[model samples]
Target: MTRIPHETSGEPNPLRALGLDTLRRRTSMKWRTYPEDVLPLWVAEMDVPLAEPVVRAVTDALALGDTGYPAGTAYAEALADFAGKRWGWAGLAVERTAIVPDVMLGAVEMIKLVTGPGDAVVVNTPVYPPFFEFVTHMDRQVAQAPLGPDLRIDPGTLEESFRRAVADGRRAAFLLCSPHNPTGTVHTAEELSTVARLAERYGVRVVADEIHAPLVLDGADFVPYLSVPGGESGLSLMSASKAWNLAGLKAALAIAGPAAGADLARLPEEVSHGPSHLGVIAHSAALRDGNAWLDALLAGLDDNRSLLSDLLAEYLPGIVHRPGEATYLAWLDCRALGLGDDPAQVFLHRGRVALNSGLPFGTGGAGHVRLNLATAPEVLTEAVRRMAAVLE
Candidate 1:
């Protein structure tokens, strides 16, 4: 294991300074998508440097000419160790794990293993847009269940959707987004247990997208769906991509709960062949050796979340901003700002601040925009300054 420097081991701001001059040189879609004047904050990509262990792991692999095919259980075992240490999830059996190209793709494959085309899949709207796209691509019908007024999953609405999806007596599935995207709500243990019970009652299989499990902020507990009671029959898609700023590397793990082992075992061998060999190496090293660096990044994000709240209050006071308990996304209600249903369009054209338009997030998305909060405090301040100028 690589040793972290004493100076940075507990530095409050361990993440490197993310200045605009340094960031604009990158070619990632988030940086290169808009004109030079536009400050891009739409994508989930972080504006931080690579963790030392991840860099060393990738470099060492290249130096030894060890890059070949993805194999072995090192990655799974590493995640198991991390989960046990960080989240207290002791039941993550490595034997039931598999590597996939990415989270959404793994979800498609998992959905296929449990259901066939034309089967309905229940999902919360104002969700990650890919949820809708992937379900359509799988030839599966999506049963939309909008989150209630509080933007948290409502039991009544969920039960209603589950009832509808299984109404024809066909086996349907539920796609759960934990620490939900766009809004960033860390679904509580009780909520997850309720979902499990409902799924069990209706005989529906559950697939949890838990990629953000490690990014729970401010001491908020992130309850992995499979860790709660009644989650034994479900499957989870987890990855180091979001937490470690490795989206470009492309690797994720698919874990099957105890009761779902038989169905997961039937997944085709071809499924494991496509994951990037280097992705596995880097992600494995991240899970095993990047805890110190991750802790530092999380600290920076905690500060940024508060910084965004202050900036919003000072500049765009009309926009309703709620500090999320997890992840670095702020779901801003811009309806009061009179930016119309798609505030992102107005912000892009007038303020040159690129944001994710909320229209595609489904029912609750209108008059809202999802802001990425995993950047430098100054960048967030500048983003709001530009957005406020749109009104001027």
Candidate 2:
């Protein structure tokens, strides 16, 4: 495959740097879930090479036979440094953070700290499918606060859900997907502040899944939910897994705001054992030394975003896609195609292109499909072509 370098940075676009044959040879779910004939662009996994720093870190640990239990606050400290330098926020207190297996597991532990069984765990739909499945599996009731027409948070809807969630003074928790999944909408500071205020008013603890924090593309800013004025009691789950293509590494951090230190401290010590030592080493290295590579990946994603829009307009004109400001996921509205609620199935079965069906994402998910944009530009274009062919 021809290597496409980022326009400004001159760094090779990770998405285009790897060839299809190279990708297919891997055993990851994104490539292996479907047969060789189907184009798989359904999951969160990014189709890219590992950052050099991450590779070196893991390789060095193995070379030294340093495979053992994870120890120290290196990951937390590295994240704090990255947060301060990148997001202009220095409030990541290492003492208030705990290592978890991954973002979802961290979220589960954080939710457990704030609510009991059967308590309502609020979410904005259509959201990441796991947000519904995992919360429900934990014995907590899932409450919906669907986003507005613009794919941003609907304060009225959110407030109404909050009111219902905490009815009769019941304990509730909000699982906030910052730089939201599927949609890729980066929540602004003002919007997040409003979320904080409302959560405070309703006595609902806010657990922000900020795994996509580093993927904020051009034209937006990522407001760390705990950095807002009214967010002192919020908890956040962050990781390099999503941003740096380290999902298989299985490492994440659960950060607590100043006021929520006590609650975070209540997290079971065994929870820390879930993350592999190699995973910790790789994640810490990514945070500490992966900026240049991350910048290249972001630029590639930006290019792919524009490319996708153009391709959709030229081919699948009926599909409505409001390009998101963060992450590499594009939530495309397929309702206009008259495909009913699950267009992904039509595309998959007929077009031989796999996509995430909207039905499982809940609420607004129906008539929609989430497309992963972290692959090569050619693959993305081909995926759209196949999708357009389905309508023909």
| Per-model RMSD to reference | 3.1, 3.7
lDDT of 1 by residue, 1-392 (tens): 11222123473454456678988999999988899999888999988888889999999999999889988999999999988888878889999989999999999999999998899999998899999999999899999888887889999999999999998978899999998997889898899999999999998899999999888875578888888899999999999999998998888999999998898899899989878999999999999999888888888888888888888889989998777777878899999988899999999999999999999898899999999987888778899999999999
Model 1 alpha-carbon drift over 4 Å, by segment: 1-16
Alpha-carbon lDDT, every model: 0.89, 0.92
Best by lDDT: 2
Worst 10 residues of 1 by lDDT: 1-10
* Candidate 2 weakest lDDT stretch, 10 residues: 1-10
Candidate 2 global TM-score: 0.97
Residue-pair clashes per prediction, in order, are 1, 0
